[model samples]
Target: MAVKITGSTGGWNCDFPRRQYMSPLFSAILLLLGLCLANAINFTTVYEWDKYDFVWPSGVNTSNEQIKWNVYFEYMAVFEERLFLSLEPFRGIPATLVWFPISGTSTAPPKLAPFPSWELHKKDNCDSIQAAKGMETDRDGRLWVLDQGSRNCSSKIWIFNLLNNDTTVRVHQFPDAVVSPSFDKRSLRDIVLDKTPDDNLAYLVDSKSENIIVYSRKTNKSWLVKTPGRKWVSLALSPIREERQLYLGKSGYKELYSASVTDCELKNEGRSAAVKLIGEWSYQPYRMLIDSSNVLYAAFFNQNYLCKWNISEPFREQRIHEVGEQDTDWPFTFALDTNGIFWMTERNDTGDWTKPRHKLLMAAVGARSYQFGTSTDLSLRG
Candidate 1:
């Protein structure tokens, strides 16, 4: 009495909906069926260095001399239920990939597997160059990889999905010629699934142009979310805003801009339209997530720090969590999960006056709830 489900690799069965057909075997398979549902996601403290706990399938650390690299994790996504991580490297290819799963409180560290070596040249559909700054997955399970095209002026966005019944790979190409309005066509920092409030259509962020090209499965006509003042790469829908607007942050720079998203259109240069200056440091603000309390958690690439901004209140005081030194393992990209924990990619130091030249390091920070401490029961945890 096991229910069969088709998976990517092989077929597996769980005792559930199929038990009705064979009720006699249900008693024997009840325990096994419970394990299948419980093992969906479990977290573990397997990654322990000194005092901090890490997420699973961490990067292989070379040069065991307590070395930490300062680089950026440009792209991050959950691919096929496994975590796909990439980083900025030096002397070799600029990209590396790590495969793992979403870890929970009962999860274990991912077992190490043989990784395919970084390729140097472009092959058929999947290019092996470097500088993969952004990555996003479509609802249909297609992966869209955005390469910086840094080395050869190859400002291109590559799309990859499975063909031949999910065996052979397929690719689609879009050149920079029909992409944007800016001349600094170096990198597409990040990709977001744009969900319009009014309709079922979504769009992707074209960072260089300070505009987002809207794509609808319903109609083929395209539109743009234009911001007149500055360019934006990281976009997040604010949870605390009254009108439920979109908050956009600049990539590779220190700035946070807000625009109301009504009917999937940006209400530009209006009274409700206001920009919040988090800081003036020159760093890339890559990925952002809105917490349950309406706070904006931002990760700065150049600086290994996690910035917390109170969007619900006036933007006067903001908290910054600097991890590594400017010349050390500065974070590049980061995300916060439902548990209020911060996950980031840590890179090796790119030497003084140099750039990042190492593999990836995964790190996490636990969030603690603080209360108003006084003569009351309100106390803060550190």
Candidate 2:
């Protein structure tokens, strides 16, 4: 005769409570399986910070007028032997793209060269591409702009052609896969140009969708790079193959992921895909860069530290570099030079979200690397 088994709300619904109906041996086996599953479901590990403090650009007053930049530091990229950055100023006017030469020394109020006519106000339909964040000049010298056009998510990719010395531009709306995934309208945050030996493509980071979109240079087709279960804050590419890492952060968990490129060309057709996982931890990592040597450096907001990591091995380990946290209630963004140096900006502790302001910061990755600490006149000049 076979024994019948059943389940109940109170406990186990035992139609066979006796040894004749259910053996003690089988009951012991079921108990062990239940305990094992419960253990697996309740597993979690907590990590704590031992030492946290600021180190570079010390003794600087964030309240000073000369260092104050009344906008959000959205993008920083190297272009034309210099670094070109864009700041999203509040109120009416479109954001400004400023340039500065790549000198090792920190310049006061950093010299601001004239923004190219393409970046200035224009009457083209592309004018709606507002609040430019990521600015990169292509091989053809056309400026690629990533606009964070608010949560309404009607953002696009705007191009400024430099061929005719004209500001003629084109704007491409966000692809359906990116904007339709969320009930909330999506907005893009940053874009990095991923250059292959044959061609170049743009990796668009949309924080709202928690994914990156890959756009083809030839087809202009867009595909999603899924970053499941994580809100990616910023992404930086290493100049090497299949080794790009993304700096991801959220309310309580902040991490960097080692993303491996998977797709490859088939029969003269160029195709690529990628998947990533958490590689390291640096709470509240807003922006970061990977140097040619594969070392990862990132900035932390509110925690008051600029952290570094070594990803030469399979697992990335953190190398904490203490940085100044004073008055920098919000450390928004950062950049890296060809020489492996790092730069950042700090938001003043106003506590008012309505008015956003930041002071520029400069630092080097090594000791005795950053000498010109806080030079007021040179901070924003660039």
Candidate 3:
């Protein structure tokens, strides 16, 4: 079943995810006198689902085990007004790359329609998406998807023009050597891109291989930045073009590291990138995102609450915008919208796999994506 989700929990789901109504605050002691706001640290639930409803194709045997198992969504990306999400290859997921229109309102839970079309999402079909794990979008109306591949396929990078009826614009499969044949080298944790260069460079972090894979759309090539012993799972790329930095977050480590995006690009510079320890946090960190305002938004692997720090400052708990509640929920997958709204989802799946314990929340933080720009459309959709 592939159709859009229009349901709203009343009047909450359709608000502008971004806004300019930032509260005034003063932190003069840190020299960022009026930079941080308290409203930026707290989030509220916009949509709640006890379990998701899929619009399945007609005549499909829903009783089949393969199509009747648990389904979990762990990756998300918001483009214009559409909130794109990917379900883990949890047996019953019919389509991994699906989306819902955030502007619509309905009483039932939103339905996720497969991107492009359901025909292009056929399982085991090499031409179709085998498994879509992570995704990121830019202001240019381009959606970057990381397909983790299946038995007869190899990991691939997919670029779809969201502005052009979600057309497939480019598909680059990673060569065996680039993704390593021996181990789970293609365990891509996340994907991010630098849209300025002609090469159209994109970076992916391999959680299993502990390396970063860089892909170039112009050259149709890819390379691995080896990290042999580390468990580098999450990564964030700076939006600052003048001085680009790719920040690395080790799964259970307290330190955050970085490397110059310029040095790790595709030109075959013949030199290994020098990794630098950018800063350290009180607790181990997980996923990360950089806003257009140059602030680093981060989630901890162990902490329930989220925090944000200006890259120019040290990543200390005392210096971050933190919510003091016994924050026990993690933003399983989150994305930033142009309106400075931080959207996150929390999933609580337990013994009863049938129960849906998922929530889509949003926090207007007074910042936008690193891509930097405003859309003419006042609505979340651009």
Candidate 4:
């Protein structure tokens, strides 16, 4: 007699002879079953906010009228156990930096706490960040803040050393050349840091200008790489493994564009070469992240499904899971941890935008973790 296990998909099936009790075929079948079970994806909520915990400084108004104003979270960065969040300056909130521990409380949901302390009038100063849209925590325990200069403020990158008491170590302001002449200020939406052996670089995306600005920390020089073909709504950097590539997502376009870091760094004065179209998707992604094995995870606009695309050969796009509802609004940004768990914020758009109804959620994307992989490669030939 023989025992046979058939997988849900037609491609996978295994058979074991009962006579050969502990044979290699039996062992392989057992391993395959274990792998299938281990790779199962699950979604779970880490933290939720029915309404934002607006804690103002002692002198500032803590009245319900003031706190009830709209405040939205656009981006987040996780370093160790601390989670850092940035508020978009849509409602003119004075405090921009808010953080809390990963292990949050249920009875008392994590309240938004100001980083570097909250102070009135600090919002207007160029030295201080007016509004930040995106942020990233590097391998060296340093946090990079991308201040978009939303309300007539200077666009700048503020680097803080989390290891050294969260002190500001470097501040780099974007020159006027990189900003678009049409807009009052460039919309610096997102940033990705590349700390390679030969070069230390930061790539910032100007959503309004449709350009990717590259900054070299070693040389203290900056340049621009314009998005080719179509305008990109968002940009994501692949994990530095064997090669580094930039992933650009456009709103209406079904295809995602990618380019090698080498081409992006090659300078013809202050501009780099345009990127080429790469993987095609069913829907335009709002945000995307690539893991160590080159698997692309994306969230789309007006869509309820979160998708994953295999960038390696035999390219395949699979809808991992669906979230929220077609009628409900979803978070514009999300992040992945070392363990492949995704952290995203969900807001209740059914209510007025002015009132806060945001929740921080987490979902386990995959079984394998990309924690040890380095994003330092740049092989981009298709």
Candidate 5:
């Protein structure tokens, strides 16, 4: 006998043959299968670091007196087998960028170190990093660094080619026009690279100014968009194919507004334009991840749950996993691998902000038994 199954509950239910249902052994086997399919999500702790484990660079003084000072790590990216981490300049520590191999032993995490001196210097100046928070690696083996320059330095984006001997390829400084007059300093938060076959673009978020700055590699020019009619205080961009969508979120607000990609062409002189509202969500997302299947995963700011929403019909949110305890520090920034696993950094919330505790974690969302629709995976290059 054949059975037909369909719905949002993962297509676990079916109309079985009447004779098969009557058999006790057959009924028991079916029950076990259903239970296994329901519990597909799993969370694992990949690496954990105590306050004393974070070692300072070779030149920096690691004496007991200096060790008392605090060090905080912000965003991270993975390319091949290497994991890159950015150290936020908190409590007088120099803003440093470092990376270590991911194949280290589980009992002992790899040591943290600064990026090579030759790659960091432009001409004669060394220690070019002021304050960096977000970074992304493209398919062409280039690592994009977003320096906020919150420490009185100029805001700039540094692109380094990792595949070709780790060479510094380009450095683009934000023009004065991109900085808003109302804010005392420019806060360049996150970066999203869109490398379509025809277009190469970078979308940088100005969280404090409520605008987005677009950079074109072909023209080597940058433009700013106000995102008219949308309150984009917590702006985030996720590009899928030719479509680049914007996600807006606020701290206390319970809703998220999304807009379609602006229609501005790269060849046009005026690259800035307004975006049209396409969708909205009931929960406020601090960080977002979309899979190959167009399934959206969100980590909330005020809540401790990791929520998943189906972009297709019946856009309902399902709380897949709980990340942390109530009113605690949760995953601030996260990245999704091609295999559908989430790599996130969890900071300590209870004690002093300087000596914050951190953990590198991984969560896997298993495949569903039901077919939702046709969708494609988001490429890191784009």
Candidate 6:
């Protein structure tokens, strides 16, 4: 499974000159870069974790067992040079949204601090994050979180202004008719943001409900597309707004599909958006994302490999690389930093549960995240 955007997603129009149509030269350059990334790139270990060491709030009642669990790191995003990770608020997890500066690299397990503050991560506060699986950051320095509220908290979308030192929070609680907190599980898994001068939109995957929920900032309302499948886990919008596409993948399926983001705007609560089959992979990609170059990257389920392809080309041409030597390296959350560094968190499935065996790794390939539009020559600026 490969994930990629066409380029031009809101907060992502920075990497290159925005164009309504991709020039032949631009496509060639993206192809070259994608090939360069497959040259057995050396991945550096920024830090590893066997147990998640969160900065526990002073007054919170957390059992010590919470830190040592084999809890998985689901999603990650980078903003303001800091890496943010979302830990699902499961049986013993304390915080769902946390971050640490990429500058201050620690040799020991990185100390994950609650974003904004510990106060904002208190479970069931309703005012805070209860459960989260996916998160994203934009060029404007805003952190967007999709909180799949537990039974105690209602599902809501949260936006924080990192530009203001994250002092402000804007939240939108989905109406129960479209989204209600589930006691058995969190339905909303992934979120993608599309921002432009004309409109601000968000697309999300409701796995259990089998729906694609579209929300608009302009209207301050949400609509649902009762999708055809049940496990719609992977999602992304084309980086180029003019050719916007919503790429999707399922947990067990090897094929990836896409739909037009515009077709999902219908106010019909039960409408189904038309989808097109993009392509398939030899292995199953459980999670994925795209880079500014329109290069789609995928992390296989419980596999030691990570693969990528220039979406402008055929899926058969995708370049797959073994990111690690360990069989336990189960890659999941991944995002590209501003400098073209590939960052991801991997779970050591066979490691000692008492220690921090999981690792956060980085590799440079001269590529930026799709959130940055496309590649550009900075010299052209001044």
lDDT assessment of candidate 4: 0.66
Task: Write the residue-wise lDDT of candidate 2 on 115-210 in tens digits.
Answer: 554335332334444456766655455667776554434556766665655364666676665555242555466665665656557776666765
The segments of candidate 1 whose C-alpha lies over 4 angstroms from its true place after superposition are 1-72, 79-81, 89-91, 94-98, 102-131, 137-144, 149-172, 175-184, 196-210, 213-224, 239-242, 251-253, 263-284, 324-332, 336-341, 348-382
* Model 6 C-alpha lDDT per residue in residues 1-382, reported as the tens digit of each score: 3323332221111133345225586885565445445344577888876666667668765567656564667889997578888875667676778888888545766677888787777766888888877788776778888888777878888888989878655788898777755656547877888775676777888766667888776777887886666458678666654676778886567878887765534334678877778788767776778877777887776676666767778765344455333455345679877777888876665444564457778888676766567654422211
**Candidate 3 off by > 4 Å:** 1-40, 62-69, 182-185, 264-270, 318-331, 350-356, 373-382
TM-score of each: 0.54, 0.60, 0.78, 0.78, 0.73, 0.80
Per-residue CA lDDT of model 3 for 275-306, tens digit only, reads 78877876676678888667777777645456
Q: lDDT per prediction? A: 0.44, 0.50, 0.69, 0.66, 0.58, 0.70
Better of 2 and 4 by lDDT: 4
TM-score between candidate 1 and the true structure: 0.54
| Residue-level lDDT tens digits of model 5 in 1-382 | 7343334334334454545445596664565456434533466767766553344546755665444335455566777777777765655454357776666566565666556442352321423766666677775778888776643456778888889867778877777787543225466666667665576677667656545677777777777766543334344455354555555554345566565554554224444444544445555665665554556666765565666666544556665655434345334556655444567666665555554366677776532101111234323223
Error of 4 at 311 (Å): 1.7
Q: CA shift at 117, candidate 1, in angstroms?
A: 11
Higher-scoring candidate on lDDT, 3 or 5: 3
**lDDT against true structure, model 2:** 0.50
Candidate 5 lowest-lDDT run of ten: 366-375
Error of model 4, residue 292, in angstroms: 2.0
Stretches of candidate 2 above 4 Å error?
Answer: 1-69, 92-96, 100-114, 118-128, 136-143, 150-153, 160-170, 180-184, 242-252, 264-276, 314-321, 327-329, 339-341, 346-382
Per-candidate RMSD, Å: 17.9, 17.0, 10.2, 7.8, 7.5, 10.0
Superior candidate under TM-score, 2 versus 3: 3
- Please give the clash total of every predicted structure, in order: 17, 21, 11, 9, 1, 23
lDDT of 1 by residue, 1-382 (tens): 4555323111223444554546566653555444444322122223322111122234744433222222234566543344555555334322343345555564334432212233333322245534455555443554555555444335444444522122213322334443542336534556544334343333345566656544343343345555556677776655422366566777546666665555435322222234455444245566675544565666665555555665667653233433335454344455443234444544445353353333223333333111111111113221
Ranking by TM-score: 6, 3, 4, 5, 2, 1
Distance from true location, Cα of 69 in model 2, Å: 5.9
